[model samples]
Target: MRHEHEPKQRKHTVRNVILTVILVLLVSVGAYAARKYYNIKHAVDNTYQSAGIKKNRNANAVIQAKSPISILIMGTDTGALGRSYKGRTDTMMLITLNPKKDKTTITSIPRDTGVTIPGYESESPSKINAAYAFGSSGTAIKTVQEMLNVPIDFYAVMNMGGMEKVVNAVGGVTITPTLSFSYDGYTFTKGQSAKMNGKKALAYSRMRYSDPDGDYGRQTRQREVIMAIMSKAGSISSLLNKDFLDSVSSQMKTDLTFSDLSAIAQNYLGARKSVSQTHLQGTGQTVNGQSMELMAKSELQRVTNLNRKNLGLDHATTGNIALSVSDASSSSDSSVQSANVNAGN
Candidate 1:
């Protein structure tokens, strides 16, 4: 009887020890996660900058209500190819997210498209990309609104060079080239899925001249790289790595604060299930030795209608607008626009 009772006590002691260890591990993990969340929140909070523009409705309220919204994505051509100068936005994609329908629409605005910068209305027909260079991101946002007659709720500017760093930060991105080409010491075969590093991803997105579809094809690749990054960045440990955070800190910017971002992520997670990609295919024209993509009035109306419908507005705003920039006619040549500094964790 003594031996049997001793064995029972030993079993109880082992069970208690196991339970204690498990409890300790759970507490440790919870604390670490809390600390990591605090750290990333602080890091993102530091990158916020207001454009000082008036809005029709409260942006935060829209998110809180789980309504659809628009975000202008600008890929600035700075911090790339060893160039340090503030540069024009090389890529502009307008994203509309509708949570109810779980759909996302991306409309690519041509980089060389023409529009009048807000402060310089008399200086009509400046390159749309010049909007940022002349008045920073505010000008760029206003330029898009004025051209499309659609309200832009937020803006995101990413340094093209920093895009490579982000690609690497997420352990690289996987993309299948729709067209076979090579640039910057990288070879891409059509219809092949390749895992691209930072530079290789840049090369894949930046090779416009060789694409059979020209700049439009390049736009598709750019969208592909971006989507890949978004899909991979969330599931990887690099998102919390020190170097990854640093790269994002110096290379990106936006108007959204940490709270705004967190709310959006919580509310809009379903909106990404369906993505429709479209672009403004404009006629390439050389005006005053400057290249331009002339978007027609009808074409403008179509895209605007789509955006408006997604925003729960009427398909109404469409009119004639001369928005092509010429080196031969303007007060100030569009300067290279500085990017906002906000980025994701």
Candidate 2:
């Protein structure tokens, strides 16, 4: 009986020790998370504002409310060349997040899309991308609002140079090149799947002229790299890497508070699983010696309706005024744009 009792006592002691170790680990992890949150919040505070524009109606809103939101992601050329913050916006994407439907829609606006920037007072309509070159990101945000008739809830600006740092930090990303091209001594074969580091990804996104579909092809590649980054950044290993975290803090600027980001990550990140990507449509032509992508007013209205519908906003506000435009004449551009709209995760 004593031998049997001794064995039972030893088993109970081992079980208790294991449970104690697990509880210690859980407590340590919780403490580490709290410290990390505080440090990040401190680092992200006091970023630049959009100068002189009204932010979306989410001033008093919380992510827990689960309302639809729109964010503008702009790739600025300033940081690459060590210039001032005033630089041309080469890439712009509008993202609509709908928590109710668990879907995200990302729409790319062509850099050359012709539109009149409000308060710009130019002699004639200029390329939409020039809004940033003329008046910084504030002007760009206001111009996008005026053109699309959609409220932008948030805006994030990333320097082109930062792309390389971010990609390299993630140990590179895998992408399939749609068109074969060489730029800056880097060669990309058509329809080839390859892992790309910072330099290659930058070249991949910057080679517009070499692409059969031109700027539209560039947009598709940009979106692909972005999605790959998102995938990598979602991993615990990537998130825990000090270099990656430092790169993100140094390279990206946004209007989102740390609390806002945390809440979105907690509640709305799942919507990314059903993302739909699309690009604004237009016909490229030269007007007054200036090249432009003239988007039909009808096309703009169509995109506006799509975004509004996804945001759970009332559709009655978008009128059918611009209804008499023709289809895009660039077949390659249209095909690339169409294929990306339903790109799967």
Candidate 3:
């Protein structure tokens, strides 16, 4: 009986020691993960603006809600001019993502589109890009929401100066030239696909004058470059690179917090698998000697419908939505005047 009791005690002692070791390992791993999470959160919090946006129609929706969302992408020309974080939105795009439908629609707006900016001097109309330079994030978001007649849930202001570095960091991107032309020492033939480095990609996306479609063609190229970058960035190899993430983190200013981005990547990135690009149709005219794109009322309505449909708001009537394309003057009526702004880059 003594020998049997001794064996049982020894076995119990060994089991307790093993349980203790396992508990210690679990605690160590949990601590490491929490530390890493907080470190990333701190870095992203310091990178950009975290202020809550005002007047967002979908402000109630959380990232985990899986609801359809709209984002305004503004590409700024700030990094080169040695200016503050503000500058003209040289490229503007309104993107709608539906995770349920797994679809993404990106509509590129022309930079020179005449739109009234809030807080602008003299109450005169100006290019849509001016919204960023003069009004900052709040003003820019308001200006676009008024123009597109859609609730913009998020806005990202990207500095174009770091675009070259981002491209280089991702190795490079491949694009199919829509037309045969030579620019910035690189010769591209029509219908030929080419792999472009950072400098070449910038030049390719920037060359609008030589294309037959002018700004429209440039918009197409810009979309292509963006898709290419997105494609490369999603690769396993690119995700593993710490340096690439650091490079992009410093260049972007946005209202979306780090958790918001993480939730989007986790849930909605699959929508990127099928992407559709659209452009606003309008005629170019010189207003006060400055070139501006004048979109017709019918075209504006059509664009509004398309964006609304994509946002799962098609059944919701936007009959009250109208753009002041005909009048460059600021209106006294808040409803009529509130809708004035550029959807362009």
Candidate 4:
């Protein structure tokens, strides 16, 4: 009777162990399947399709020399439906990521800055914001490329509707206001550091009339909000959630492919540490009976040099683009910078 009881106990223990192993395997497979399913679904839905974007199949060729890459970051006011021909870029930031120095520079163009439209020669000088309405991202990218004489490698365009979602997704953001100003029924006091949500964050950035520096003040706030977003983005927790990824996919329109984005995420994480904020210096004036912000020839050369130097390009070898601008500047004091042309503020 003792021997029989021992045999039964052994059989029961073996059976339980086998069942536990099976359960573990099943759980592991299920999790993998779920992850794969979500990845496929999101990829299909958010696959970027844009004309101006080009992929370097040989990633080695693109980054061998530690050259700087330029990305045009446009925050559109497209609401929930996403970007279209009719949409406008409410926020425009030109970001240059220098791999050699591991530095980044952000130049914010005012929405009200004046420029000449490429195709619409008859339209006279117009506000920079009107370029999108006149043409698509290709036009916008081209306009900026011409203005700055920098190659725009990629673009990440997102709607303002996602601003709130992004802030909430990241928990929240802390911002230090330089001056107190109220707009759109929101009140912010000077020297106050406030925790901002999405709507409040939008309000914080959009209030310009009350600011002493006009659009420059507003642009500064916008940069602050962007920095806050970047800070939240850096906290690894933000990237772990499937829900957050899906929401971001829905909100952003980009020319960046998944592989390109992955490489950028890996290689350029350190670039954010060296962010420099630059503003274009120009006097507000009217050109040909149209309101414009006229940037000096010297200022244009300075910007061009900064961009070229950041890109690790030998100024003499990087095509005659720089020289062309330099030559154009010699004849006319008011001759507009090509890179500044058609760039909406």
Per-model TM-score on C-alpha atoms: 0.76, 0.76, 0.74, 0.71
Clashes of each: 10, 0, 1, 7
lDDT (tens digit, per residue) of candidate 1 on 1-345: 011123433333322221111111111222235547765665565456676787546777887888998878777755642244557787787878788888666677877785556786544455677677666678888778877887888776767777788788778989888788779899999899999999999889888878877766776576577667756754325455556565665566777777667666666646656555557767777543456677777778878887877888776866345343343244233331111111100
lDDT of 3 by residue, 99-152 (tens): 888876667677777666656634336667767766677777777777778888
Cα-based lDDT at residue 74, candidate 3 = 74
lDDT of each: 0.64, 0.62, 0.62, 0.56
- 2 versus 4: better lDDT goes to: 2
The count of residue-pair clashes in candidate 3 stands at 1
lDDT at position 235, candidate 1 = 35
* Predicted candidate 2 versus true structure: per-residue lDDT over 101-211, tens digit per residue: 987776778887766566754322566777777676777887787778888887777677677887898889998786778897788887889899999898887877877
Q: After superposition, how far is residue 124 of candidate 2 from its true place, in Å?
A: 3.8
Per-residue accuracy of model 4 over 175-213 as CA lDDT, tens digit each: 889898887678898888999988888789877778988
Weakest ten-residue segment in model 3 by summed lDDT: 18-27
Off by over 4 Å in 3: 1-43, 50-53, 58-64, 78-82, 121-123, 174-176, 191-195, 230-234, 270-274, 314-345
Off by over 4 Å in 2: 1-32, 46-51, 56-58, 62-64, 78-82, 191-195, 230-234, 316-345
Note the residue pairs that clash in candidate 2. Answer: none
Candidate 2: residue 246 Cα off by (Å): 1.8
